[model samples]
Target chain A: MWLLKLAWKNMWRNRNRTAITIAAVFFSVILSILTNSLQDGIFDNLIKNVVSFYNGYIQVHKQGYWDEQILDNTFEGTSALEDSILALENVNALAPRLESFALASSDTLTKGCLVIGISPEKENSITELKNKLKEGEYLNEQDFGALIAEGLAKRLKLYLHDTLVIIGQGYHGAMAVGKYPIKGILKFGSPDLNDQMLYLSLPAAQELYGAPKMLTSYVVGLENPSNLDPTAEILRDKLGNEYEAMTWEEMMPEVVQHIRTDKGSLVIIQGVLYMLIGFGIIGTLLMMMVERKYEMGMLVAIGMKKRKLMQLMLIESVFTVLSGCILGMLASIPIVFYLNRYPIKFKGELAEVYEEFGFEAIFPTSTNPEIFLTQGLFVICMALLLSLYPIVKIARLDPVAAMKK
Target chain B: MNTVIDAHQVSKTFNPTTIPILAVNNVHLHLERGEFTALVGPSGSGKTTLLNLLGGLDKPDKGSIFINGVDITKLSPNALIDFRLNNIGFVFQSFNLIPVLTARENVELIMQLQHKDRREINERVETLFREIGLEDKLDTRPAQLSGGQQQRVAVARALASKPQFVLADEPTANLDSKSATNLLDIMAKLNQEENITFIFSTHDVRVIERARRVITLVDGQIHSDTAKVSTEVPHTAQKRTP
Candidate 1:
């Protein structure tokens, strides 16, 4: 108790030095929290974007369909197939797709496009497609409708009720043709996906594409994406060799690979942040140690134990560092949330870079509590490490030489 | 009478070069339970070194020092600290009060070291400061106090824990003659009334006068140990003819 008083009093003995040191720790913690939070938010957004666009945690398909993606090789089952999947637990949203590649023409502008036939009533229950429409009404059951990507519509000079001519290799390499009026234009999230996608009713697309008994894939969303791998494995075992189950990670291997490769570089960034934090904390701790040197000497010379002096130094350091780190974290929570809600807008070339990478031009964030906790833990740990040196130096100080000052 | 401090042929050597420089050479000493002893010497005479060895603040090259019948030399660094906390007090030439602490708080430092309760420390601090004429200055930090007041605060700190021995290293060196006289008078009173041992390493004749016994050191060895005329009796200044 006596030593605690001394340690407390000793910390404030040199006001200028102590204050500067504490300020260094405070700013270091703040920078660390901000950088880590921003990075966490960015990474989380990347995953959410990819998941929303195509793969919803898991996808079920005929074993060879994923590799070939032909209209003939699809799992064509109704409620029974869905029941088998739903029986396994945690199947949140299931979307059945009848897919084909076709050349769409309007005013002599002909471009190859992937037309995915969907049931609008079921698609809304399965994916975010309903919410992605930017023009007119969504895919309506009453109309022989089609939802084309915004970019594809722009290229075809299309609008609602504008006829689009679709030509494709139908059943058994036979030519098939269809004329469809665009019911809606989808504001497709990924720029790449937007340029090539077209949606239609299941029955209309089956007859038009001449694949009356085929379905290309089943896209399933889960309540928790973390169960993706386990759920895929379970479905593969139950559905057997005739059908293959894939997680979102497998559905977009390129995106997964990008994240994996980025991990190495991100570690380098974390290291740089830690080093920057180290300098701030260490600089402050060094000053704190220096200011206390004389007091340490007196304590030793006057009958306080050397070890007690060391303990006093540690107590002083931990108090200052933890207080600053906790305060910084408390201040960061709302800022992260507000930023997450209204993402940072990018402009010009920067927006182009994001679009090229199939992401929104806005720098999206995830306001996860883990990000703040992890960052605060790192800063406090760093402060504790920086503080250890002074305690060690004090324990070994020579009282005679110390008192001479 | 129980001896508060007992030293046997204690030596402290510093290596200035290839040859060892003997700081305190084979000095044997004892302070009885209530004795007020002074160690007087010129500069570099190792007065502070002897005091350090007695306080367990520094290690000696040879011999053992015991305080309150415990052999401090044999104790580990940590144990030595525990020993110091419970057994000894110090008053430095510079007063050496932690500048951030109040006058009473400085006095309470030793009691805290002894693991005394806050109320006990506070009560003792209040009484000690009041006794030393610092009752009104109890809450004033060291920097706010005058030199004499700071020294008095230090004196209060030294006695606050009820330590067996108080080692003062030239405690009056920085004080004005009048302040020095007043400090010595208070210390002498404490020694007479409370039977608390006060050991001073000083060149100050005032301190020597107040001490019941004077141990004179020359070249790190004790030159003489002479009993003073009486307690509270000031030493007559004999003008040395140049």
Candidate 2:
């Protein structure tokens, strides 16, 4: 108890030095936390945007269908299968799609395009497809017309209400052909999707492809996207061997690879930041040791044990470091949350660059409690590690020589 | 008479490997209980070196020192520190009181290190402060106290743990003539009334004059050990010198 009092008093003996040390730790913590929060936030937002724009959080396909996406790999769409999937806890909604490539033509132009068949209202609920409609009316259950991507319509020189022709091979080498009025022109954030997508109502597409009651894939919406992997696993197990449920991370390895590479770079940056924090703490501790040499010699001469003196120094360091870390965390709470609420938007070329990659051009911060705890604990450990210098100095000190100094 | 300290063939060398300098060479001494003694010499004559050897602050390159019948030279470093805490007190030339602590806290520090009971520590500190005539300066830190008052507090601290003896190295060198005389008078009174042993290494004539026995060192050897008849009696009734 007496040692504690002495340590506390000693820490404040030089207020300016102590305050400078604490401020260094304080600003380091805030910078580290904000950097981590922003990195995680940007990646999370990218995943959310990619998943919601077209593919739902998880997809269920017939066995071997993802590997060979042809009309032959399509499975019969069953209401019982949909009911059983929707019964799961995290499964919010499901949309069944029949998709294949066809050659599209109008008047004097022709282009290769992807034709998708969807149940209008169910697909709208999952992907919010109606919101992307830029011209003409959206598809209905009875409508025989199709929705063409704006870029695809421009390539074919077709307009809304114009007649369009599609020709492709059907299931079992059968001939498949269709002619329909373009009911809507849809715009997509991704240029690749906008250039080649043509959407048809479920029954109309089933008839045109001569594969009635078949679906290529089932898009599963989730209540909590973070539970996507586990939910997909549960659905896969429940559906048995005939189907395979895969999360977006499994289906889109390119996106996952991008995020992983970015995270690796961030780790290196964080390492550099922690190193600077360590040096700052070490500098302060070095100054303290030099200043207190004479006093320490006197204490040792007066029969204070070296072990006790080391303990006193450690307690003083802990007081300084813990106070700085706690204050930094408290100060960062509102700033991180404010950034999360109102993200920083990019302007001009940066905004265009983000859109080019089919992503929103804003940076938000994550409010994960783990980021705060991990960063705070790591810095505290670093400061404590550097405090070993004083203990070693005291252990080897010669009282007579120190007093002379 | 109880032998409070005994030094047998004590010697210390500053740099034995290259250009060696012998600080204290083959010295022998014994201190009895309640003796007021001064180890006096010119500069670089090994008075302070011998005092450090006796106080267990440094170990001799050769020979053994016994305090209260235990040979301290044979003890381990940690054990030496514990032994010093229980049996020896120290006062430095600079009045090296811990600057962060108040005068009362400084005086209470040694007793606390000895793990004395709370009430006993308080009572002893109060008595020592009164004896040193600095009862009113209890709460003042070392920086706020005059040189005389600070040295008196150092004396009180040295006696707080009831050690077998006190070792002071040039304790009055930094004080004025009046402060040095008052400090010597207080130490002399403590020796006379409580039989507390004090051994100082100093060149000050005032301290040497008040000491009952004076041991003079020349070239790391004892030149004279004289027990003179006391002329100046310890005047406890004198007013506190500020």
Instruction: Kindly list the per-residue Cα lDDT of model 2 for residues A155-185, writing each as its tens digit.
Output: 9999999999999988777888999999999
Stretches of candidate 1 above 4 Å error?
A: A1-9, A141-143, B229-242
Highest DockQ: which candidate? 2
- Which regions of candidate 2 deviate over 4 angstroms? A79-95, A100-210, A221-241, B229-242
Candidate 2: residue A205 lDDT (0-100): 89
RMSD in angstroms, all models? 3.4, 5.4
- Model 2 residue pairs with clashes: none
In order, candidate lDDTs are: 0.79, 0.88
In the range A30-129, model 1's lDDT, one tens digit per residue, is 6666666666667677776667566567888888777887766766767888888877777777778888889998977999999888877767776778
- Model 2 lDDT, full chain set: 0.88
